[model samples]
Target: MHDQPWTTAPLVAFDLEGSGSQDHEHEAILEVGVVPLVDGHPDIRNAYDSTVNPGRRIQRRPWSSPGLTNDVLGLAPRLDAIEPELAGRLNGTSIVGHNVNVDWRLLSPRCPGIRPASLIDTLKLARLIHRKAQPRTLTALLAYYELDDEVTELSGGQPHRALWDAVGAGLLLGALIRELPHGGSLTVTGLHTVAGVSLGDAEQTLPLF
Candidate 1:
């Protein structure tokens, strides 16, 4: 098990905009954004964003509110085309995001060989820290921290874009880490334990690649 303190480790917070909620075999990833962190701080200069063609037309659903339309994706590269670059970014870094399981489900099958060193779900982190904070969505968490305006500025006043959400998720992770009660330092394994059995089996430390 990698036992590095999360505060000092290199991490990557990412977000995905997919065609739908359920991870059906046919469902496709529409957009992906990655923000790399050094010592728990976002390295915005190296952030990455890409639009992926799911090999099929995106079906619009009430629950799905993707910023990219099928027409936009028509000109984008396929998943296989960018898997090499994406894999390079994810490998050897601890992964962080809000409701990250959805992103993992959409990404792992596409990139069979990439495995993150660890994983942190900000949505789960928030629940563990502040259970009474109503509407624990990313938007709500940003608002809770008075960061909604800052996110708007970061994304050129846009929300739901993968890059924007990735940046926001990274910022939220930093804030949550700061909020941790002082004592022994926060480690990747410790955070995973707090995430509990409902997340997955305790022994499965590495994320689904």
Candidate 2:
């Protein structure tokens, strides 16, 4: 056999929820959640979550959201405090996420030291795996893979808790990776071409396997 491709890449399934809207650039990441994986299993010991104080006030734009506020982020840690740990975990790993690019923009500036060579996006993977799906959001995939029961209990009220969502993402990743042809061994350059991402690096793409 191919030795199961997902197990080939050292992946870190992650998610980032910004303080404001989903526009991302203007809306700073209030919380970041990471679930590191090695050899097809969740590396619970290495998992991490952090809350970033985006410096500017987290405005609750009524147009997009009504209940969201800065109060939800009051207890989260600032970016400076979380940088060391963030750099250590993300230094050289393949990132797998619902939409890896969105998480990248939220995470990159915080740690100038970390640059991942490979990225596997579950969103893009969904498209490659299923051609006729209506949409490929996290919820959609959860249902598509019959993982709805696994995550439905988590869907009522939690807006942006980092650790909570991180745990959930870890579970979802465990399920999602099974759907990929190569468990998770997709290249950053290849994903960029598939996702139309501008991976601005003049370096050769590394072998994720």
Candidate 3:
């Protein structure tokens, strides 16, 4: 499968909004969104978005300021309740995210036995491909690639939210793929190379705005 072209790979754009803590171990995921790539295209119509009710009180506002408060989250389903659904969708697919490691960390513990086919971080790709690009925030990359407007129009939610960011990351993947020398002719391994060999190396090279 690694030798398969990226466009044919089962890549899903995954993202989540967390409740207050910077420490992944302590924080709780408040929302999750998955935009599955259909032939390398974001399938927004079939995208999954769900708000998760944190079991405990959120100590502070989430970094994204998603406005997911106790009152709001209390009405949502707990992580375990949706674990089956989550596992079914995420288990067998390779997930792509702007800073995927964080989401993986936040999610792995909550949903055990849920493993993805691969993890492709766009942040790492930007570090290697567009080294000079300043402030590689997902929004910045989207704007630079002229995809911000289209992402906003297609995503049902707003920025800082799960669904919107998932769409942004998904489309951003397509944009970056076109920037490659081989275009859509590249393999999944080629895409991984863009993410770099060292897991945490590319992350240290670029800081999101």
Candidate 4:
């Protein structure tokens, strides 16, 4: 292990964009993206993204985003088809992402057996590190940390597509981790010490991460 909270832990930045915000609601998962990082940086070529069949008719109403459509998802696998693979990659890894709770809520149930021991949120990390910064979107943080060049080019073609966003998130975290004042005080026990809670706890000790 690398000694940090996520040391020796394979990292996967995952994202899920959906038609609606319900775990078991009528809406569907529009897209899912995953970028696995080893030793802090994205492997790039190994990224995964998929549009899924919701098993029901996709809403093609005016309120829907153009990107969320049956046409986009027509060729993609159903949610059930991809669940096994997603669960396998996610097992025992430290998951990092921007607004990761959304992703977890939508997909975690499909992988009921896997319990991530650690999680790092770039969104929370950004607020913690740059509380005084003027702007704080993921893109802004990328620029602030001089990481825009590394990731901006990757997501350019797909933009908001789930997988590309996941990769961008991985890049963002990689940049933030490297830019930390001293690589951050990131030991597993140390994090538990300061967080005042264990990773296996069902709920967070504090409302915020």
* Clashing pairs for predicted structure model 3, backbone only: none
Tens-digit per-residue lDDT, 135-158, candidate 2: 566755666667555443432224
| Candidate 3 local distance difference test against the native | 0.78
* Tens digit of per-residue lDDT, candidate 3, span 1-209: 77988878778898988864554356778999989998877898888888999888776643644667778888999988888887888887788898887777677766876777678888877776787846589988988898888988888668878888989988988888787788768887788777523333323422222
TM-score against truth, every candidate: 0.84, 0.70, 0.88, 0.77
Could you give candidate 1's per-residue lDDT for residues 37-72 as a string of tens digits?
A: 877767777888889887788777766655687888
Top model number, TM-score = 3
In model 1, residue pairs whose N, Cα or C atoms come closer than 3 Å (at least 3 residues apart or on different chains), thus clashing, are: none
Order by TM-score, highest first: 3, 1, 4, 2
What is the lDDT, from 0 to 100, of the residue 150 in candidate 4? 66
Pairs of residues clashing in candidate 4:
5-186
Task: Identify the runs in model 2 with alpha carbons over 4 angstroms from their true place.
Answer: 1-5, 21-24, 61-69, 151-209
Ranking by lDDT: 3, 1, 4, 2
Go through the candidates in order and give the clash count of each: 0, 3, 0, 1
lDDT of 4 by residue, 1-209 (tens): 55655444567887777776432444467788777887667776787777887776675655454476776678778888887777787777767777666566555555566577566677766666676855567666767767666675665434456766677788877565555665565654432232222244334321221
For each candidate, the alpha-carbon lDDT, in order, equals: 0.74, 0.58, 0.78, 0.64
Between candidates 2 and 4, the one scoring higher on lDDT is 4
- Candidate 2 colliding pairs: 6-182, 6-183, 6-184
Better of 1 and 4 by lDDT: 1
**Best candidate according to lDDT:** 3
Q: Could you tell me the lDDT of residue 157 within candidate 4?
A: 35
Model 4 residue 80 lDDT score = 80
